[model samples]
Target: MLAAGRGYMEERETGKQEAVASVREIFGLSGPLYLTAVDWENSHHRRSVAASLVQGVYILERDRQQKRQGHQSHASPWWNFFHFQLISPLIDDVDFSIFGAIYEYNSSVFEHNAPKYVIAFRGTLNKPDSRLRDLKLDIQAIRSKLHQSSRFQLAMQAVQDLVAVVGTANIWLAGHSLGSAIALLSGKNMTKLNYPIETYLFNPPFFSLPIECISNPKVKHGIRIARSVVKAGIAVAVKGQHHSSQKDDSFFVLSDWVPYLFVNPADHICSEYIGYFEHRKKMKEVGATKIERLATQNSIGNMIFGVCVRDCEPLHLLPSAYLTINMSQTPDFKRAHGIHQWWDPSFDGQSELHLFR
Candidate 1:
């Protein structure tokens, strides 16, 4: 009986390996693959630019995975496809793994309507080697400690250095999932410093309940009002004590620098953003702007920490964004939250945009 059980377990493991191999081959994981075939020089709009930036991020993932499999140098076709060259890879010192990279467009080949440089960060990978550190950062993000992480600090410094060298007008930032959070935070920090850079965030996590999933509009509205009132109370309580003029100025300045936010309704991790922006519009319509504005800037967690320890802002709160929602149907959560969907030809046309302030 023991011998038979061992044989069955071994067979199952082998089957899983074969299945994984098949999937990888189909997706061209063994080699470089382009997600889109758009003409780079002829087309230079939001969709095209976003595709290039997201692809740069995808290459970062491929580069690291290839290295893990003992490949010394893995040439990425996606970077070449967009006529971009890998400049410097952002490394996580703790794990010595590549979490992000900077790509420079080939100026001689394409000069019109192209970003001079793009810095992209990859999301979490479920692989055995890097999962520990990646998840550690994810947890830190939830606790608002992501800014203090070595990886985020490295990303922020890279952005600052690049901006100093090339100026903020020509640089772009892109990331997916966890990477999106890093890019978003980095962009926010730079914006606060009076250097706003163009940013693309794909499926960035919103560390709140999926209130957007509520089917009834009235119930959802009621819940939002209740939550806002509670947060507003906290904001008022701490208003006189911890609120500083500099902090208010920072938030006001950030309101004018809007980043491009790409989200899918099926992706619960990011879908709350849809409701978040929509709720603000509704608040304006109903004359709750004063309460909403106060609530928007303060959260329970940040208020408590600000009074007790130090001032901290909610990571997910943003003053403005060019919110683009993927309206196309997705098969599952993974597909919905995937970075690949951002570049899909069908998806390019299926997205709807709303400018939120």
Candidate 2:
């Protein structure tokens, strides 16, 4: 009888341990290293401030994954760690899943220098359930049809509603990868309406050839100038077709709303932005400002497509941005494109910033 009682107690203890392990795995805490908390007060502009925003977007992914696994937790560990309360989740009508969230700041804990509300969007998740819709949106983004997508329309409406209520002074927009593209488009539209809100974009795709990979500087510069001349020619050819007044107004107006763009040089998906901004500066130095300005506003592919289909603009082109490049050597593309790296402590002093205007 004594031996049987001892065996039963041991089995119960083992079951409890297994249950704990299962929960940890569901919450993405199975690994040895976990996410660290940020110091909200001391978070410098580009360092900790950027990390917090990126982390907020990451938590949206976590929240969805946890619920998908039947954990059904009311609170997210990551959001709680950052002292943010989830106001409401942005759900996909078709999938009936959460893609983004609006978080309200804990004013008691963080008094000043913080956003009153942050709307964060998560990138594509490769899971079986969400893969189809997410990939469809990504393809639409590449084709410049993202604006017509249901998800983007939902996001735009959310931003507009929030701005209407809060007046856009303390509201912020943040996202990662595909989410970043959505945020970028939303910010651009808001700026066009003269409602400029703070935006943080992580690993935003540039949708161009990875020109930064070319080893020879002279070769790269020559190629860029050639492309610019060709694009400028196309712009002039179609100048009569396009509405000059609207195009010029939007181009100059967007310059006032600069979004914070964080990218990794090792990640090809977004590294083209580095070359785009650098080449513009070089053009100015070489006294090719006229050609560069025309090229920047229009793209040959977009122009031809717009003529055939409808009026459309290149999704990746930006009039201005505060671009930050992670110079740290990452092990792989997955890590380089990940949202976690934005919050890594090693990111400090390992980044370069350029104000592209």
In candidate 1, which residue pairs get closer than 3 Å at backbone N, Cα or C atoms, i.e. clash?
none
Give the per-residue lDDT of model 2 (tens digit) for 120-228: 8777765555667888888888777888888988999999999999989888898878888889989989998999988888888777767877889899888889999
**Per-prediction TM-score, please?**
0.84, 0.83
Each prediction's number of clashing residue pairs: 0, 0
Candidate whose lDDT is highest: 1
Model 1: worst 10 consecutive residues (lDDT sum): 1-10
Per-residue lDDT for 159-182 in model 1, tens only? 999999999988989887888899
What is the C-alpha local distance difference test score of each model? Answer: 0.70, 0.69
Model 1 stretches with alpha carbons more than 4 Å out: 1-45, 48-63, 66-75, 305-311, 348-357
Q: List candidate 2 segments past 4 Å from native.
A: 1-75, 246-248, 307-311, 348-357
